[model samples]
Target: MSSTKKVKDSHTIMTQLIMPNDTNHLGNLMGGVMMRWMDIVCALSAMRHCNTPVVTAAVDHISFQQPIDLGSMITLEGFVTRTFRTSLEVFVEVYSEDLKGTKTKCNDAFFTFVSLDEDTKRPSKAPGIIPESKREKELFEGALRRRDLRLIMAGRMDPKSADHLKKIFS
Candidate 1:
């Protein structure tokens, strides 16, 4: 738990073909299905970062930018942006590629996961995360504010008590 890992070390990528079963009546990929995929990839990234079992604590932000049609290839990529004492934040992006290789960003989201003790099944310390790239660093910096916001929304923290978010409101 004393070791720190780079964001790239926990990067995860998954691809799935949107089939009839994965679509809604309009032939667009169902929102639930997209969320499922995001959860899977994000969990994988979180587990990789912690090197231990983890559980999804929350889905912080999700934006459906565009509709992905059936028959398209969907790619989901995720990485650990930052780590808390016992939790980690993962950022995931989903893209859709058409038959002709036309790609469009479909969704982006942030997920939080809490590392668990293998025997006790209780919250455990997670390894630190080091963001190397500019984008990774940006996300790493923003994660705390996002976490603060999530806590406020969940009633787990007071708005005025948020470290990063209070600056904006103040």
Candidate 2:
């Protein structure tokens, strides 16, 4: 991997058509189905950054803003927000499109994945990411706080020790 790479270097996009199997009785896409799509797109972004296979470590703050109707077109875009030693966080935004081609943001989430070594099957170093655009910079900065929150929620980190989070509430 290079010393660092741009956010666009790991950008990933996916589109899916909502079908009966992917929907609930209400004809809206099932939350689990949406989550599965999010995971796939995010993993792609992570793998692009690391140049190695990656596994989902955690997913946080999944917001379902709108329901995707049956037969509607849905697009999910994911990019690496930041990369650490052997893991990275991806921001995925899901949009629902109508027949008229109008799109509405339906869901969004942050996913963390660990890069893996093919031979040893252990965590491996991941390339760092550089934010170029304003939105990318913002997400890159906030990634640390979001990662801290995930760790706290998972009982892997103490809330008091989250310096990035402290700055927000303080």
Candidate 3:
């Protein structure tokens, strides 16, 4: 919860070329397709951080604030927010860029990934924090917030909704 404990320097930036096949009847990239790309971008960051294969544990939240048209350039940025014994929380931002170099934020989401020991096919510990900059700290702190939000959304903090929460959260 403290700012000093957060790490913020780590980041991953990627650009994707949208194709006709990724579009819907409306000529815009499908939301599902974008989400899949987001997952890949986030996973790449997690793997680079841990130096191991990672599997998606959960996606905390996804908001499609803007539509991305086919043939537009898609930019994705991802970074580590936090790490547990075997899991890492990553935040991803999606943007659509135009030929004139202007960019629009399309979506932002938090995803949790668990590092896996490929040989054992089981959860494994991630690398230790070596944050060297203020950005890393901010990212770590943000990840903490995302984790809390996920718990709250799952109804873990609501007593009255406990039953409904368990069925879904579990």
Candidate 4:
């Protein structure tokens, strides 16, 4: 790992064509299929940031804003939003592209992954993310709030202790 790295350093993008096998009977891409793609892209971003193998710890706040039809092109972009010890939070955005038209955001998700050491198979330190653009900085800050929410939801943290979340919900 280097001494410093930017969020752009770990950016990852993947594109897939929705096919019959990836869709439901309604001719729309299945939620599970989209989730799988999200996981893969996010994990790759985390790994790129840490320079090590990573494992998905949690996925939070997956929002499906639009339906992707079969035969449509789907693009998934991911980047590191923040880091916590051995864990890194990855933000992913999915876009649906039309044949003779533009691309629209169809889904967004946040994923957490823990870096792993190859030989020791233990949690390893991950590189810190240096947010560059305004959007990246905003997402970087939001990741901490989302992490607290995930911890509270998983019974690992108390609701009252999550100040960021309390500010919003309370």
Candidate 5:
């Protein structure tokens, strides 16, 4: 397989208020809610890259390095890591900023998304390539590593599942 290098564009979304609804009684943002936001932002980035609707196929990794407090501003930044015929892999980084203007990276994750045709609900091919840069190359390499690990895990589960998983993971 010829590796198709994709140039990733950084996209960011700013959200505020970890919120009582988005948090526990202790007022820390719930991991699930944060993850959902990350998915949305990453999907947006993929759509921008592919110029088509995208759906989350899998979340490869998520790590919470710090806690986000209620009412703090949360910034989610996403970038394309790589692309296949019909799928794009994205990496997202979440940061928390306090009233005092301190910003810290609270979480990071890698997610795979597939572009879909609205009517057919089938995978759609993405653009050939974007503008290549050093950052894009680095992110693509990192995402490729994660993709390899996911393939290994899928292969271990079952042969049939691995075949289906390969289509999505690619």
Candidate 6:
């Protein structure tokens, strides 16, 4: 695998219309429905980045900032922020657009995925992210801390061993 891949190399965008079936009785898009889309887009981005079968390891953070009503167009965008030994982090953002082209950010999330070897069903290395924009660079730097926090919360890493997160509190 190459040492690094540009952010655009694995970026993914999906658009869908919020229909009756995707909304609740209140006529707003359901949280689960939005999450499902987020996971799908994030997984696609991860697969694009790794060029292998990837599975969702964890959804680090997902925030529904605003409610999207039925009849709105929903856009989900995802890009690789950083990569670890066998896993990579993708930052996903969801926006809702009205008929007039007015856009509102509805959700934001970070997802982690691990690449798998098709023959062995084992974890495979992921390519590193080479940030192209300032925003991508910032996200790339923060991804390490986010990964440490996720590992600590999942009991896969010790709090004391999390250098990036430790600095946050200190």
Global lDDT of model 4: 0.89
State each model's C-alpha RMSD to the native.
1.0, 1.1, 6.2, 1.6, 5.5, 1.1
Instruction: Tell me the tens digit of each residue's lDDT in model 3 across 68-165.
Output: 88789999998887786787888899989988889999888889998899799799887656555677676665665566566577664555534433
Q: Report the candidate with higher TM-score, 1 versus 4.
A: 1
**What clash count does candidate 4 reach?**
0
Q: Write the per-residue lDDT of candidate 2 for residues 62-142, one digit (tens) a residue.
A: 777888899999999999999878889999999999999999998788999999998887998888888999999999899
Tens digit per residue, CA lDDT, model 1, 83-114 = 98998899999989999999888879899999
| Cα lDDT, all candidates | 0.91, 0.90, 0.77, 0.89, 0.75, 0.90
Ranking by TM-score: 1, 6, 2, 4, 5, 3
TM-scores of the models, in the given order?
A: 0.96, 0.96, 0.79, 0.93, 0.81, 0.96
Candidate 2: segments with Cα more than 4 A from true spot: none
**Candidate 6 local accuracy as lDDT?**
0.90
Model 1 whole-model lDDT (C-alpha atoms): 0.91
lDDT score, candidate 3, position 30: 91
Q: Candidate 5: which stretches are off by over 4 Å?
A: 1-10, 156-170
Native-to-model Cα distance after best TM-score fit, residue 98 in candidate 4, in Å: 1.1
Query: Model 5 clash pairs?
Result: none
Clashing pairs in 2: none
Best of the two (1, 4) by lDDT: 1
